[model samples]
Target: MPLRLVKRLARDWFLLGMLCAVVLAVLFPEFGASGGPMHADVVADVGIFAVFLLHGLGLPAAQLRAGVVTWRVHVVVQTFTFVVFPLLWWLGDAAVGRWLPSDVSLGLLYLCAVPSTISSSVAMTGAARGNVPAAIFNASLSSLLGIVLTPLIIGLFASATGQSLSMGEAVLKLATLLLLPLALGQLLRPLVGAWFARYRPYTNAFDRAMILLLVYASFCDSIASGAFSKYGAQVLGLAFLGAVLLLAIVLALTTRVARGLGFSKEDEIAVVFCGSKKTLASGVPMARLLFGANPALGLIVLPLMFYHQAQLLVCSLLAERYARRPAPPPGA
Candidate 1:
């Protein structure tokens, strides 16, 4: 294969490269500084707009409706993703406080505050023959709520991490960046839905491209802010371990609790995947917006970066395993 083809292949498969590029750009932002703070904010806004547009393209309305109507599945997934997960994070923080670095601790706290992974939740729910609709509703709802909840959770619990936004400012930004596009998407749903159905593959590709850009920008900001110098590999390693442990605990609890609540295999899988995963794509951007000025925000996002990859891998395996599990004995 030609070298150009190799490069293209690498780009398609390489999440780390996009992340590093953004990190580099942020590290030496002077390469072209026309936008300044206003530009940075605009990029953030546009990126969010693009995100909502992409999500709208594949909003899964039918599945969402089905999930919402199935009150049992909806309740179980939401309770785990929103309520149980946050409580577990708090407990984990207390249990592991002494071992966690201040910045890593803050990152973990922020991770706890984020909503579940939307696309992944849908995909995993499908794989496990779970309530995909419930997964969609719960996951999307989590993201919607996350806009307000993330900032509040961070401000309340992770004060020492030095990342705080006034409730009013956070709400305004979220309304403008996220909710507005969502509303527009809803209004244009017929058109967007048709486009998505006709060119599903391309729509998904475009969405990934937009996320790739945001990922690059946010990571660049981290590098530019001198975050790399402040935090070492040892600290990062600890954060990775903590993130894995946190995810594992959530996964196990959600599955167990869902089963106890009389949820089927499908609902159990949805709960585990949605409740266990955090949005690296969304969280990084939010961190930049909320803690852009705080130097520590860079450190705070490091664990999330690790957690994002780990969750994807672990859940991929678990989703498969659950899919293959034999049906429970009748009336057992």
Candidate 2:
């Protein structure tokens, strides 16, 4: 109802803006340039660095410590978020490999390989009255794990996907862009803690802006690379269906698994948020690393992009619905 809230919604509607950007780019490729539209490939690389810097600010020390102590939640969330998703992606690619272009298959694979998102997971957890600390740890661990694991996963599948690169190269790139900056931020936390407290509002704004820029650059690059030509409406439709289905499946499985492990309803919700969602913020950078500067990245990130927005919208609605309901009548 407030002006600030309205603006926040617009920022989160980044996916819609991205769709519009892509359509415009496809229609008029030279819209942004005096000489010509800026190359999407170049902007993508820059976008990766931008995202990591902002990611550093949100690193959750308390949540991470709590997760390390609990251990079980960590194991369950990680097993599903990292292990299960990647495997399903590979199997899906193998099943549909022949029907889809190799690039589309590869893109889908990359989507599965990306880490869980940090901001949205925590946000949704808070909205659902779930364990915010655990959500933070689940999402943070995914990104850290991704720095090493994603390169390895991609290396194993690269030959099949026809985009082979040594794991070492990708690891080095990820370390430089993501890990090193995060480490520096951690080291500086003590000295800058007061500053962060003082300027928290501004820093938050900057972080949100970086996310928007990354989304814009990623979709813009997709347009410039002629990525849309490779897939028809049919493929896009199927990809959307696949994303929704996979999300639902993962969400249901995570809830069951968490409860089986004896977690409370709130903890189960945290696990669901952390396990079911994928991170487009981290995915784009990882895709660029694995796929090179090729236009195919547009397709590779397409499913994840759509899934990212879908998860947010659906989860937001769900969380709000849950929030509105009264707490179960005092231990009923």
Candidate 3:
């Protein structure tokens, strides 16, 4: 490749790493599958705990408090994440689910149901000179709410499909795996918060590494179980296209609705970024708990992985555009 092309690709190193993970899983499925010698599941569980603990410690209480007064902005962002996004997926699936593999369809719905991303949404909002505090609050609140709401949404869909989903069991596991660690971290924040602040880069790397491990393990299990053989490679293409369309729709709706609600430009930026994005950080770990050792877990998380990268690419450009706009007159 040309030098410029290599530099552009280097910027998406994480996405490239994810692709390498899938290839590894395909080639060496036994090493990372559920009963694999590597014992990936146990390692993933420990990593998940650490990731959320770091999240709790790093989140600044003052930023969350500052954003709390902007109730309307929160409402808009959360409504899109938990309500509108799912409805769109439901309608889209109703129209096309029969044509797609069941697992892929469910993956799209799950993608819609997960929480807004934390680091990227806040980073992009700040990049655009938007309401960073509100972005932080909404992103954080969305993750907390998703622990309950995502399972509930999945349960409802299971019932409608004549499949049994134990909402109680799912919620209990999530509370144990996710919420408990988070609360403990918050309790310990005063003690370790300074350490977390000083070592932010290390914590971020830890988070990314955990996610890549989860992805490898998920695909390993799926491949070992012959899950991907049921569908052709075109299924991957479909998932990517679905992610693009879902993102485009949500972005347009959020931008227009924010304007319609008479939000200032900064608030609109927060609403658009927070509402349109979903977090792989939360989604991958949640999928492991929600689906257990189901062979379809890889297919299930495929859309989320695709959407994660797509949002980063699209929002990076959108943030640049917003950043280029003229600043508003002081105090007016």
Best by lDDT: 3
Q: lDDT for every model?
A: 0.70, 0.72, 0.89
TM-score of each: 0.84, 0.84, 0.96
Question: Which candidate has the highest TM-score of all?
Answer: 3
Give the better candidate number (2 or 3) by TM-score: 3
Q: For model 3, how many clashes?
A: 0
**Candidate 1 segments whose C-alpha is farther than 4 A from its true place:** 1-14, 19-39, 160-163, 326-332
Name the Cα RMSD for model 2.
4.1
- Tens-digit lDDT string for candidate 3 (289-315): 898667888998999998998788788
Q: After best superposition, candidate 3 residue 56: deviation in angstroms?
A: 1.2
lDDT digits (tens) for residues 164-226 of candidate 2: 767777888888878887777777667776677688677766655555544455555556666
Q: Global CA lDDT of candidate 1, please?
A: 0.70
**Model 3 segments beyond 4 Å from truth?**
1-8, 159-163
Candidates arranged by lDDT, highest first: 3, 2, 1
